[model samples]
Target: MKRFVGFVKKEFYHIFRDRRSLFILFGMPIVQVMLFGFAITNEINNVDIAILDHSKDASTKEIIEKISASKYFSVKDYLDNENEIETAFKKGKIKAVLNFEKDFSKKLQTENQATIQILTDATDPNTANTISNYTGAILQNYQELINKDIVTPYQINTQTQLFYNKELKSVFMFVPGVMTIILMLVSAMMTSISITREKELGTMEILLVSPLKPLQVIIGKVVPYIFLSVINAIIIILLSIFIFKMPIAGNYFLLAAETILFIINALSLGILISTVSASQQTAMMISLMGLMLPVILLSGFIFPITSMPLPLQVISNIIPAKWFIIILKGIMLKGVGLAYLWKETLILIGMTLFFIAISVKKYKTRLE
Candidate 1:
């Protein structure tokens, strides 16, 4: 018991000695929270739009003013002709173009209706959709304001249909990605660095010769990180639940089991990395350039896997984070059970076993 406690103490000392690294360890989650919560968003604001007003009248001008006054849009240019609209969009002068019909006020007065065309650059589909929605909403509000005193004989109702996620909350997407990053950072990157640090300091030989068996030594080194990784998962879950109001739709036990499986896979991968790396820096480089970058890019964390090129999509199948994210989204957002997630669960388990076995074989081969 004392020896095990000493092993844990030594590991803790090694970790905490580097104040800078320690700061980054805790800061990672906070930074992820702030980044996803504040910066990465689909919400449109302060978007520059171009207007081609043929009416050039008070009512048309008023509509433009209302759109510009709102926090969502900024009317940067008053286009002269239809030709200018294409030029403005092509030159990146505007995201959207609002074209008012020549007889807007006259048509509104005589026929109680007028037409306007909203053309948006659809290169970035999500942003373009949001811009269109914002424009439509502004126009609808303006229509209601002008027609408030004058009620129409007939009524038009708007029915909105939101699939899967009714609220369309960004948290549903960000939270799962945040969990993946935190796990990858804590379990894979840190573990590899820690093991390699011991190797660099020539302390691994001393531990190997001690009373503890090889497996025991490995466990002693890994236990602390496993605890930390699980704690991180819990913290992320709590933050998602309490702060962001994200739902945990699946069984908690199953979620936890899957998280542990992912952590084990990460830790095993780290161990495999440590076996090949000669120094802490090498391990860190491998973890960052090799492990972390793949997790961020190919894992569908920031981008969709389906949207990737065929070869890249095939490559992504081997990335552990990709499956874990699918599992997370299924359980957390979709409320799927083990039956629905059995394939992902099996993939993670297979990966964990494969990494662990390979790491063990390498460790034994080195010892011999």
Candidate 2:
């Protein structure tokens, strides 16, 4: 027990003595959270739009006023013709062009409908789609407001309630994802690199040749990482809760248990990497390129899985971080329990076992 305590103390000394590692371990989580929370966003706002009103009538003028009044769109240019619209788009001054057909008011009064063309630069599909939707919504609202005086025979009123994130704040979604990624990075990548460093320095062989069991050595190496990862998780959660005002709807104990499970899984993966890697550099590169990218891109962290291609969707199934993020979201956002997240929990357990088995096999083979 005294030896174990000394080992832990040595680990702390190593962590504290290395300013770079300490900065990365403590600072990276907060930096990632802030970057993802503020810098990265999917929600569209203040999209620039150009208008080409051929009618210049009361209805067209009113429609333009409605669009300009909307928070989603800012009318950047009043286009004189279709040529000007194209020129404006080419100049990158506007994302969309709204063209009202000739005699729009007259047509609306007589035919009960008027054609308004929404020409958008599809270079960025997401922005284009959002701009189009915003335009359509403004038009619909204008029509509804104008028709409110005359009651229709049938009216369908739709009320949409966006659960979990009422404001559809991207930060709410990103906080849990950032937490998962940071934990994975610090626990798995750092552990792998640190363990491989011992092997590179010829210390691992000495420890293996000693009375210490392979499991003991591995656990000792991982113990510090687990402790650091827990601290990081706590810091991130506290920052999200207090600074960002993010909610923790589920049981705090359950959340901690799930976080520990994810950390264990990540740590096991790190151990597996350390067993396979010949050097610290190799382990670090493998963890960053092989693990981090997939965790960030394919884990449904920033992009929705439904939006990804079929092949990419299939590929994401293998990423343990993906399952961990889903579990976190279920518990944190939806306030779900084990019953709801059992599948993801099972997947994480399976992945951890797979990694541990592989590491054990590899280590034993190396010994022989």
- TM-score to true structure, per model: 0.57, 0.60
Clash count for candidate 1 is 0
Candidate 2 lDDT by residue in tens digits, 1-368: 99999999999999999896886788767755643454345665667778889999998898888888876777888988867865565444466788888888887777677788887754344455556676777777777787877644212121222235555566676788889899898788877886688888888777667786666767777788888889989999999999998888777998999998899899989999988898998798778866886788778677544345456668889988888877776677667678767888899989988987887787667666
Q: What is the number of residue pairs that collide in model 2?
A: 0
* Candidate lDDT (C-alpha), each: 0.75, 0.75
Query: Per-residue lDDT tens digits of candidate 1, residues 25-137?
Result: 88666755543454334576667788889999988889899998997888899999988875665443366788888878887877777778877654334555677788788
What's the true lDDT of residue 268 in model 1? 78
Task: Spell out the clash pairs found in candidate 2.
Answer: none
Candidate 1 RMSD computed on C-alpha atoms after optimal superposition onto the true structure:
14.3
Among these predictions, the greatest TM-score belongs to 2
